[model samples]
Target: MSSNRITTLLVANRGEIARRIIRSARALGIRTVAVYSDPDARSPHVLDADLAVALGGTASADSYLRADKIIDAARRAGADAIHPGYGFLSENAEFAESCRRADILFVGPSPESMRSMGLKDQAKAIARRAGVPVLPDAEITGDDPTAWAAAACEVGFPLLVKATAGGGGKGMRRVDDLDTLVDAVAGARREAASSFGNATVFLERYLDKARHIEIQVFGDAHGSAVHLGERECSVQRRHQKVLEEAPSPVVGPELREKMGATAVSLVRELRYLGAGTVEYLLDDRTGEFFFLEMNTRLQVEHPVTEEVTGLDLVALQLRVAQGQALGIEQADVVPRGHAIEVRLYAEDPARGFLPTPGPLHLLEYPERPGLRYEVGVSAPGEVSAYYDPMMAKIIARADSREEAAAALASALDATRIHGLVTNRSFLAALLRDPDFLSGATCTDFLDHHQNLLDPAPATPTVVHLAAGLAASVSRRRAANPATGFAAPGFRTLAAEMLMSAVWQPVGREPIPVAYRLAAPSGDTELVLDLDGTRHRFDLIDLGADTVRVRYDGVDYPCAVATHRDGSIWINDATSQSGWVPEPRLPDRTVLAASAAGPVSEVPGTVVAVLISEGDTVAAGQKLVVLEAMKMEHPALAGADGVVQKINVSVGQYVDAQTELVTIGAEGEA
Candidate 1:
């Protein structure tokens, strides 16, 4: 075995994973180089690295997915090794081979090992050979729709058309019947081509009720490998894992050993090297597990396993890449306590979990014991439309699963994220859910509990009042000199003339607040009238961005922030909310503009135009499809109408609220 060490490591990825790899490499005294697209020039990961290289494009195809560009960057940066951080070229066998050709160590398994498990069909076949149980599946070999449908039928009803080249729930579609099978296959192929550069896909029987259990495996050049228990990632949306935990709630020690041994056997058969995860689907009713696929790179949810086992998987990968021996044996491996991780994404749960990329006016995570934050973006930064919408991964560890879940939920509640819609509230709600608490979670967890996807309960009236008062006070403070204050927002005609302002909570109607400030000295009192109702509050203290008030004898402390766009954000002990100040003079032109037809909800590139000008469409019919952050979102017609104009075309980039199709009622023109 060679004794070469990685001195300068180049991370060939972006976002949290890049930052994560840099952290581990830095701790080991390795200089890290970060590669980024044009949009990620100033991203946190790029800034965190010791050196940065620009790939010079906005989209992944033009930047991150360019293997040649990455290889060039590594050579330019004089990197000794390249770490593909769990996406993009992380599982690309050709990229790994390119690294090998360049004589730069790829901190992962062998390229041959990757190819052996890269394709789902091939991997399943290999698993069967290794005595690992696999689900029934059929490979899609041709472009013929009849052949594809025949393969689906062979796999049976309610099957999944999955891309052979990628993970992370991309390039996959579920077809329940023959009618949609062809379209599903076509969509999956397109998505797979876009994401993995491989349009090849296969069919697998869908498991409606199953637990996603993945065994983390590690191997070295010296022919030793061990499994680091399992992580249950059943809490998902659109087949994408949202929450993950270590030591699955359903697996006992015996089952864990059996699964782990089975996973280890497969890796050992391939003589796999570095960090890898062998995923499996454990049937909820049958208590049987089937090999799903093997991710030839570090998994996104590796932190949960790290938290429970106290092992740095990245460090291990680095060591393995250095041709080192597996320092510990299977008998030495032990997992303790429990760890839970939730992916905090810049997305709207109420709106089909669509990605919402925008400025993050305020991004703050509560500091507490047992809480670990792997943040990808920063406040004053924007979630670019070019990459994944995940902002951070929040993990909590405790003595038991219940405590870990509860702590994570509370921490999420305390986290202050503003300026864009997110799934933070939904994640917290799911964590605190009774079924989740009881460990009764499966792949269909979100499907069965659809209520969690709804918008969070409206911000309480008191919170809104506090935000309004805070905004008013801030405005007054800024308007008046520090020494000339006669109490913030105070009027000389005090009681006779109350200050009024209009505040609107997000997704709610405007509310008018008429408030009077009292007590120029101590314990200020606020009298507020809202909707013909009066309420009184005792103002204990007011800081730059926080307010402490006594409403109905209950002390409420709220943290408030105002965006550059005049939007106010408030976070209290229970909930977080955002408010926009109603303009004093509404724009008549905007009010007169038609609010009709289908519009893009997020910024993306139009991938498909399903309707042309003058085409008659029914309600809920997909008129256009936009691809953003590697996910497809269709603009559906709101009502039956004839398309008046097709404003967008394929390959056109658009912003949020950009009209894609202008539809008019029949004979309206």
Candidate 2:
């Protein structure tokens, strides 16, 4: 065992994971350094670190993935060790070796161990040798399309073409039939090469109904290892885990013990160290589990395990890296109540979970018991298109799974995030889903339940009234500072004239609101007319962009914020909505410029231009592929037509709503 102590550590990562590691290191009296890309220079994680170094690039390829630059930053910061926090070279065995050659402690497993398990194909072989059950798979050996088809035939239909090098749902494609097998393999290879710098892929049998269970395993240099427990991560979208909970509801004491022992056995066999997760696919039909791949680094969902086990996983990683023995054994491990975690992403669930990268005008989390937030960006901060679009991880722990699920769902509802679209409401809906609450989740949960992606319910009239009042009150207050003590909209004129304004709520038609200030008596009263109906309400300015409206003896406190584009966002007790005031005169030029074409829904770099000028295309044919937040989004033809013009080229950066290809009528010049 080595006696080297890590006094100063550099986190070779950014965002919430980096901040999380810095928090743990600071708690241990160790100073932390942070490395960031150009976009993350002013990020919360960089500000939280004792020292920060800029790598000077916007994309991960030019910045975070530069192992040489990261090591140099560590050396310049005088850091005794480097902590690769989950992505961007975290599982890179070559990077671990580089740290060793530089005499810097890598706060993870050794290079040999990483190499043994970094690739899925190799990891499955090792797990099989260790007597762990594994599914049948065949590696793509040659470029021959026929050979690829043969391998797919051997594995059978309804299989997955998965990248051997990386995890996190990247470089993975599900092919249900032979006709799409080749395209799936090609796409998976391109993605794998882009994500992990490896194009190698393999075909694995896809279980129709499977529970994605993973065991958190840890090992130390002193030949000690332990399994904290298992986490259920079956709920997914595009093969990426959306929610995770500790102590899976489906696994009882006997099953948990069996899986935990298997995980620990693999840990011992590989002599693994630090935080690692052993992923398995439990076939719901047969009640048997098969080895997937082992994540050789800390998982994004590690917080759920930490919540239930009452352990600081980052602290454990640090201690193990310092050559300290894991004092606790398998028997010492005890899991408590249920804990659930959901990844809050800056994406539009209604739009196929497309990445929505933009400024976060307002980000607020409800403060409640048993609720934890591991946030990456601050309000008013930008979610760059160059990186992952995940904004935060919200976790809740309670005595039972039911309680935990309810608490998380409620907390999500109370969260106020504005500016760009997000999957907040979708997550809340999923948590309250009957199947999810009953622990009947599988890898295809989202696929089977697409209704969750539907648009939120229409904003209630009460909410709209509250929002209109709040906005009017704010404007009135700003206009008359000297009359701060006076009632808002209190016109001295005896004639009560109605003020009219049209407000358009998102995903709904325009609403006409006519209001007039009533004669103030004991309290301020505002009279409102909606759809030829009249109502009276007592309005009170609560200050700080908040207003309280009393209707039917109930007080509703509404928080209001305005976007730069003049959109008004209001959050009331029951719901939140964004309303844009309709201009008395609409811009005809802008409306006329909007034409039918294939446009990008989010900002991204054009990776492939599949169509050219005058090219005839069918409806739903892919015309251009845009890469944003490291994921490819294909812009498809809207109807059968000839491509009138191709406006974008490969590697060109485009913004949301930017037309990539304009399709005209068939035979049109």
Give per-candidate clash totals.
Answer: 0, 0
Tell me the tens digit of each residue's lDDT in model 1 across 58-90. 998899899999999999999989999888889
**Superposed model 2: Cα runs more than 4 Å off:** 1-3, 455-462, 473-544, 549-555, 563-565, 583-593
RMSD of 2: 3.4
lDDT of 2 by residue, 480-532 (tens): 76766665545666656788877766433567888776546655677778899
Error of 1 at 540 (Å): 3.5
- RMSD (Cα, Å) for all candidates, in order, is 3.0, 3.4
Worst 10 residues of 1 by lDDT: 584-593
Say which candidate scores most in TM-score. 1
**Angstrom error at residue 53, model 1:** 1.4
- In TM-score terms, candidate 1 sits at 0.93
